[model samples]
Target: MSEGLSTRILDHIVHLSPPGTLEDSADAFRKLGFTVTPGGTHADGQTANALIIFADGTYLELLHFTHAPPASTAHPWAHKPPGWIDYAFLGNAGTPSVADTINRRAAADGSGVRYAPEVRGGRTRADDGRVLEWLITAPAPSEGNGTRASARGRLPFFCGDVTPREWRVPLEPRSNAEHASKARGVAYVKLLVLPSELDAYAKELTSVLGVSPAASSASQVVWELERQPSDSQPYQAPTLVLNAAEEYEEEIYVRERGAGIYELGVAVEDAGKAGVAYTPYGRVVWQAIGSR
Candidate 1:
């Protein structure tokens, strides 16, 4: 495997809800046995969120618009209907930024991958009046001026924090990481791509992750993640799975939301609680994978 980008650690996955449903969404997740933490409004003031943090440091961000939708169709969340909208990889602002590193690798390999310039973003904590900031870099349109790629959510965006990451993702009070449903952390994320686009997306993801797929077939590609060790229990490394949207449900999903993350798999401990659950925000497919 190529030494992937240093910033490839899974950060968090975003679950978007309809306008003004932040609190409702949070409450719904709590009922599902998660511990939801209050996340204040974004610097933009139009969005706010709550977080369901996991033992392994990855989290589920339950978010919603605070007011009317932005008028611009170019906005990431503009016209986006509630569901799993995006996911992020931890990143940094350094000599060779995450975006620069990935783009450089793509250039070297003749893969035309381009991430937009990093944008500054932050939010205040609702529990405490603290401010946290970060830089975001997402896939951008390739002008065809390059070697050969283009797409979105099929790959993760990068989020590099300006403030202490702990302040932004507090893992203290161990109970916060303990869910009644026994979910330990993200197990895998599955994206549904049009059959014709699978090959291109596989290349796009390989370029972004800086590593080749651990397993692949004509219909699916899998990249196994090396997870951060948990304090309470050892975890099986997570996996990122991309496959063609040929099933009826998958086809419908692509028609409705295009190619993007449609489901999340979380590692859980209780067999009784192991199953699938659909929420207004997103679909969760969990399993009873005991500690390693």
Candidate 2:
């Protein structure tokens, strides 16, 4: 398997809310100066979402379940709380499938990172009745202590579009991208992990993302995702920061909820002008470019 298959793009980050709370979450983000677009219910009729699109083809997905499916259905959103949940990476459209390649490579490298078989997924646009489709690969379920572990909020999933990307992301009406707070795009995602699990999770991330952790200290590690250069753009890539929970005095999500996405760093035109509101779900950190 060729390296770097998983680093093609950072597709989207997911934030889950309580059942029937999609609009509330969107309202909160709107107050934060984001343009939130209404998304439709999934084909399964179990969940729905709203989107916050960025210029770099990345987005923030605010997801909430409409109703609980039957007990026989095996979806993961049945009992999850509101917070920054899972995230996805864009997969390549070429050659051997990204999911298969990652699984094979993990086996070869002894990384123990395994993905479930690819599955078809789709949603109907509530605004236009248009249907959008895609293929998704998620982590395989594991069992421990006589209980099945959930990959919902903890693991990264892979998505490859079956429909045209443009159809899913419309370009007309450029005003939708504009924000009152001057926010641009995601700067980084902060994940909290226990110190004992840092080395193992770091190895798994290196195998899955095809990027080694760039800077590491006793309390944190950072990985830089791949980004294409544009003539009008400066040099920078969205990052993933894994912080150790034990080193901090304040409580982290991993301490209250579990080891998963703790916060998000959003890039804005000016950090001083940006204001952050703590929604019921997760924390959003607004920072200027090149600021620590």
The most accurate candidate by TM-score is: 1
**What are the per-residue Cα lDDT tens digits for candidate 1 across 1-292?**
2344465578889998888888889888988889998888899888898999998888888888887785863557656778898889887754356777788878887777878778899999999989999988888865556643335565788887799877888888878788988888888888888999898878878888888899999889998765643334565767889989978989999888878798899898886677799886588987778632
What digit string (tens of lDDT, one per residue) describes model 2 on residues 124-232? Answer: 9778889999888787877879987876566688777788765565534555556787766778888888888887777667667766688998778888876522112
How many residue pairs clash in all the candidates, one count each? 0, 0
Clashing pairs in 2: none
Model 1 local distance difference test score: 0.81
Predicted structure 2, TM vs. truth: 0.90
TM per candidate: 0.91, 0.90
RMSD of each: 3.0, 2.5
Q: How far off is residue 64 in model 1, in Å? A: 0.8
After superposition, the stretches of candidate 1 with alpha carbons farther than 4 Å from their true spots are 1-5, 143-152, 229-233, 290-292
Residue 196's lDDT within candidate 2 is: 81
Of candidate 1, the 10-residue stretch with the lowest lDDT total is 143-152
